[model samples]
Target: MAKLYVIGIGPGRRENMTLRAINALIKSEVIVGYTPYIEYLEELVEGKEIISTGMKGEIERCKLAIESVREGKNTSIVSTGDAGLYGMAGPILELAKDIEVEIVPGVTAAFSAAGELGSPIMHDFCSISLSDLLTPWSLIEKRIENAAAADFVITIYNPRSKGRKKHIEKAVEIMLKYKSPSTPVGIVKNSGRDGQEQIITTLGNIDYKKIDMLCVLIIGNSMTYIENDHMITPRGYDL
Candidate 1:
């Protein structure tokens, strides 16, 4: 049976990708993904038939992958970070009925960014994407507020984009109602990839201009703190 593998490449870096993910790509006759993600795996996908599309073309890309699978071609749909987390897996599964699907998970952006910023997600945490394309801003804002109130170490994805310039600012304002201005915040850009950058700043001192879609913002909980330039959140371990 032809299998459709949903593989997460993990921060768009070969080193960060799991061996299982690489094997799935190797077995796949066709590689389908967003243009930028495809370019990230150019070397690995050199001989495979590439079906690339731009952002917001997820349904089309998933359909192409499904079509390839129906034609007896082993297809792998690539996504950056964990396929289940704001990646292509969900859409692919939703579109693929009566089709065999295998999901190969990889390191998510939150974990990748956390590694570069130290251990900021040691305790309970919740991830939320700020992009209001599919989900309404009202819901995203409410989630931010609830996460803030719960004091969960928050990992924010799609923090900012060109048109959503003030979204991050608004999120910060909501968080401030529950969290202190001095709460630790870690910003990691291009995590696990070349030209990676990390910044440790307080919630009050965050430079919204320094963030972009490619970056992951980790807003610490009430228990989080910065020491020796590392954002550390304790998990109730007495030390």
Candidate 2:
């Protein structure tokens, strides 16, 4: 039996790579990941076998990765952000149910963005992926409405992409219907790396078209505020 390690590479920087994950990668006979992720860590696996898959076909890629291990070859599958959240962990678990799998966690973009914004996630919040690829828009619509209705601070992942541009605006519309337009919106691009851009805006000011897959947008609840140019969402548990 071979080992299948599901790993999250975090964002882009090599320093953010986990020691354990690196060790696993070094031990694996093959490293499989998205094209960009493979390119990002290409140096680490010099001359090693890598099966790079495109952004789509994530499920098929996972199946191939599982098969590699099931066939007695060590494999490491890569994901961006934490493997447990919106990463390979879910699909890998769903696909490799009968196969022995190891989930190696990594830093998620929400936390990286939150840390740069000074604890917008310190309080109660919810995360929503605006992509309607695997998830239906109706279900996503209801969740957005309910998130707004509940006044929960929302951390939006994959808020906007090439074909799915209106989801973020729709989310903004839903949020504004229930909350104030002045609600703080913090956006972090390429968080925790060079070329990072951070912005503290409002729901009234969020331009959906400007966001991309690499961006993590944090929309604050009613109580969320900006102080000293830092976006802060109170934990609601008074210290």
Query: Could you tell me every candidate's TM-score relative to the true structure?
Result: 0.98, 0.92
Residues 46-136, candidate 2: write the lDDT tens digits: 8777888786878888988998888888899998788888888888888787777889989888888998898777777899998898899
204, model 1: CA deviation in Å? 0.8
lDDT of 1 at 10: 95
Whose TM-score is greatest here?
Answer: 1
lDDT of 1: 0.94
Candidate 1 stretches greater than 4 Å from native:
none
TM-score of 1: 0.98
Q: Output the number of the lDDT-best candidate.
A: 1
**Candidate 2 wrong stretches, greater than 4 Å:** 236-239
Spell out the clash pairs found in candidate 2: none
Lowest lDDT sum, 10 consecutive residues, model 2, at 205-214
Question: What lDDT does model 2 reach?
Answer: 0.86
How much does each candidate deviate from the true structure in C-alpha RMSD? 0.9, 1.8
Residue 59 of model 1: what lDDT?
92
